[model samples]
Target: MQALTRPYGALHCRVDGPSDAPAVIFANSLGTDLRLWDPVLPLLPHTLRYIRYDKQGHGLSTLGGGTDISDHADDAIALIESLADKPVFFVGLSIGGLIAQTVASRRPDLVRAVVLSNTAARLGTVESWQARIEAVVGHGLEHIADAVMERWFAPAFRAKPELALWRNMLTRTPAAGYIAACRALSKADQSAATAALRLPALAIAGDTDGASPAELVEATAALIPGATFHIVPGTGHLPCVENPTAYAAILSPFLKAHAHD
Candidate 1:
């Protein structure tokens, strides 16, 4: 485990693969930790050093205050710049995707390429996000856990016993962390910046994803020039968990192609 301490708090991260390998960092969705990419790491090209971390307020990381997507992006950039020996390939999902974009735009030299999964430049209406924040603050994470689960996993996947693990993870997430992230999302609208990025990029969508539908994910891809887009059939928002093979099939080639570019 590798850790980086910031003025506000510290981030807990894990790195695997050869030390001399190219770096590929993954940022997970809201309510999930670095483990979100566990299924996909083993399937990635062994030539890459895969890195995953628990962002602020999730997993083992501290829940800091007064941060937006850019600050989250900076934390990722700081982690990579301090640890990685070379430029990194970044992959992010949902809110993580927003952070990925901010990273690319603000620090293009540190990033070689990026893959945006199940996310968009702009999410739901601000009012809807505020309602969600209020619900979580007023009631508890349990209040919105089920509805979020519906957006996260397909019905078939939900029926399986494995869903309980994710549900537990969701409900266990710190309320302050979840609410702060929601407020950040409510204010995020990265259309122009995302559209302006010039890099190797791919956008992934789960066919059954309700939160970030295929069209929404594709739209983000369309923002970047030469970006490739794909859809993972049968999976929902968090496709990396449901079908790691499918997610890796698309990502491995991108990493290989852009490893040196």
Candidate 2:
């Protein structure tokens, strides 16, 4: 793992492949860290540089106050500019997708393309997010982690032992950080901004993802002109983990096609 200090806080990251190659950066979903990409990273072509990092307050990264989607974008931009010599293909999941959209919209030159998975323009009902924030604030993340995990995985996945491991990771997340992120998600509005994106974009969703259903993913894909959309079979929100092979089948070709030579 590598560490870089940004204006907001310290970020912990992992890099793979060669520095001279086109860069690909992975931003994880809410409550999870860079480890979420463990299953998919090795499958990426070695010709491209890969970067994965823990968001502020998750994994090895430190917690910072006043975090928002814009702040997250700043962190991503700072990291990319400092670490990669070339422009990058940005990949994000859930709230990470929103952050990627913000970065691409604000700093088009920094992004070569984007892959947004299991995310939405407007995440959810403000009321639902607010309730989640209150739950984490009042009772701690453990109180809601189970509910979150249930929503993240399909019924069959939740029955597996590996799913318990993922749940354990969620249980360890700091309540304050989780709640802060929930607040950010509650206030975020990317509908107009995402629709305006002019870059090559790919939107992927899990067929069973209650958080980001097929209709929402289609709507999001439609917003970006000529964006490609794919739905992973038998998966919910975390397709990268639940159906890594299928996720990579869709992802690898798109990335290979878009990656600069």
Clash count, one per candidate: 0, 0
lDDT of 1 by residue, 12-115 (tens): 89999888888988888888999898888889899889888988888888877625887688789889988798889889899999888888888888888999
Indicate the residue-level lDDT of 96 in model 2.
Answer: 90
Minimal lDDT window, size 10, model 2:
62-71
TM-score per candidate, in order?
Answer: 0.98, 0.97
Relative to the true structure, candidate 1 reaches a TM of 0.98
lDDT of 2 by residue, 1-261 (tens): 698897656899999889788999999888899999999888878798989998888888887762578778888998899888877999999999988888888898999898989987888878999888888778877787778887798888988989878988888877767777777788888899888899899999998897788788778889999899999988899999998888999999999998863
Per-candidate Cα lDDT values, in order, are: 0.89, 0.86
Clashes of 1: 0
